[model samples]
Target: MDDLASFLRNRRARVVPAEVGIATDTRRRVEGLRREEVAHLSGVSVDYYVRLEQGRATQPSEQVLDALARVLGLDATEREHLDRLARRPRRRTKPPAGKVRPELQRMLDLVAGAPAMIMNHRTDVLAGNNLAALLFGRPLPELNTARHLFLEEDERGLYADWDTCTLDVVGHLRLSAGKYPDDPRLASLIGELAMGSDRFRRLWARADVCARTHGPKRYRHPLVGRLDLHQETFAVPGESGLELVVLSAAPGTPAEDGLRLLAGFAAG
Candidate 1:
């Protein structure tokens, strides 16, 4: 129907068969749990749930939404987003989301030993510093972080914890979608990813929403081998659509040494 269908489908795929004590079969073909399975767990009619997912059903009551949320095990943010989407009468288009500021580039470059970049809520890598370029490789035609994460083959090798990165990307995009449901580019990006990668499509359906300002990350650097770094994300004052992300390591740590090595080897 709209994002609701996608959300339900995605959330359904994330549930484990045994999670609800359902027996498993290797022949099960659907991504997470089947539509009938979710309906069964939520104690709703399979036909009604199918209509809801197909965008044919009327607005659901609070109890129904709560039941579905509980069945899917949605977190607070995800549950709230679902409520908003369900209440919305129709979809309206908005302009493309915000862009990176010129100052972002200058700020990104000032950092010495860290990999730093600016990205929009849609995970578009608008600009990055030399160290970031060295660490993550250079530009792409699309310059979208999620695209690079899912579409690029080498990305799987670059991140030591690829699966964590995948979930994080999906979660961030889900959060952004919830906040700006009308943004055209965001919708387009979501559709593109859903069409491009099965893994991406499966994750997108799960309705996970997260925005982590700071966290630990692991990367595989050819020069320094495995590097563990902390990522800190800073707001740019005026834009909800853009933020600054910097990756760093504690001083004297091996990851710090890797950052130093990249800086020294890449300076112009």
Candidate 2:
């Protein structure tokens, strides 16, 4: 219920009245469309929408959800996310923390071009090749990607573009929370970040969700200088929510040379 309310509030903040062909006034104090505006646009009573956003009412029906989604300009992903939130919360069982399969580790070993890691839904780095360990730094699990960005002091210098990285990391965490709302570890992680970082709290409040399977990322490695890696994510077959993330540069590129240098340095 709380997640549903938070999602609605976040969506509301991103929409503007005038942009959606509604009247606007400077007298308004809120950042985006008000409750009444959304209510009106969706053809729902203000009291009903208020109760819905406050999480005081029961789960909204499909008709109501469709109306809200349309009024809020939610994309396919966001619309699906909205549906999940609006549904009644289900009790979910947590699986044991998993190990990367032997074959997966072997595959990682064979990938000599770049850093690679196996990550779980909660951003725990289950296993990593030598290059990933050297670049991300340190022991298993402690190097949780989201935690590194929000809680680690040196992380500010590790990524060339800290803001973009944090957005992606937070979005990753937010998406996981929606999928595994009952996971205590994830809840604890979110609580820790909320306590530790005002910036994190603000971003988390936006309630965005993104999964970057393939993308470019900038890093400032201590040994290799600037690196621009094209990252790829693959889901482990027969493994739920396990992703193999590989970061590589094109052949003969400076970034590729940097990875080769770092791999050698990491070996020693």
Candidate 3:
């Protein structure tokens, strides 16, 4: 199925009918709301909704999209993704990677106490501070976070909750795929991961989408034992796809002490 159709089917299959006030029965064979049920609840014709699922109806009006989003229980990020899938041209060439601005690199360097890096939509680590280099075991430019998490066996041991962390990574990549539908680099990366890792393929097939803006992450550091940090992400001003991510620990915590110790290692 096409992306839009696939996304709709996945979302439709996930919404439990009873949760949405529809009475459930044991006789029902479908996982969630049927196509007709969605159409009726969303106030659209079954034919139109079926056409949407069949990829024949690509452009739905704002009212229709909002109704559908409501019915699907899409969060803000997923709602935006649905809109993008409905509106943007299906194919576009992503430009070649650009160098990180000197000022942005400087900003990373100035954040000496924590690990900070810049990445694009495809999770290509564009630049990172020295501390970040030490934290990730390589400079950001040398890493694609998704590739590292999914392909590298040793990388799994670094995250305290590997499954949860990797799930977010896959979801983030799905969101990116919605934005840049035909980005060859993204397609290649996804294809490679799917071929190389069964876990990645399973997660990708779920059609989940998410944005990891700010969240707590726990790391199992070989040197420090355990480090729990909060990550903050900011969009780079005037830059289309670049994001700055910094990881910091709360004051007076063991994680903070560990980071300070790591900073010392970075310095020497």
By TM-score, the best candidate is 3
Q: Candidate 2, clashing residue pairs?
A: none
Better of 2 and 3 by lDDT: 3
Q: Write one digit per residue (lDDT tens) for candidate 2, span 107-161.
A: 9878886888899987889988888988876765567887887788445588887
Model 3, stretches more than 4 Å misplaced? 90-96, 154-156
What is the per-residue lDDT of model 1 for residues 1-268, given as tens digits with 9 covering 90 to 100? Answer: 2467777877888888888788878887777788888898888999999998998886888888999999888988778878867877655424344566677678788887888888887888778888888887776214787887788744548888788888999988887776677777788988888888888888765567788578899998877778999999997776656788899999989888888888887864
Could you tell me every candidate's TM-score relative to the true structure?
Answer: 0.72, 0.91, 0.95
**Candidate 2 local accuracy as lDDT?**
0.82
Span of ten consecutive residues with least summed lDDT in model 3:
89-98
Report model 2's TM-score to 2 decimal places. Answer: 0.91
Q: How close is candidate 1 to the true structure, as a TM-score?
A: 0.72
Cα RMSD, each candidate: 4.5, 2.1, 1.8
lDDT of 3 at 101: 87
Write down the worst ten-residue block by lDDT for model 1. 90-99
Q: To one decimal, what is the Cα RMSD in angstroms of model 3 from the true structure? A: 1.8
Over the stretch 1-71, how does candidate 3's per-residue lDDT look in tens digits? Answer: 12888899999999999888899778889998999999999999999999999989978999999999999
lDDT, candidates in the order shown: 0.80, 0.82, 0.87
lDDT measured at residue 91 in model 1 versus the true structure, 0 to 100: 55
What does the lDDT come to for candidate 3? 0.87
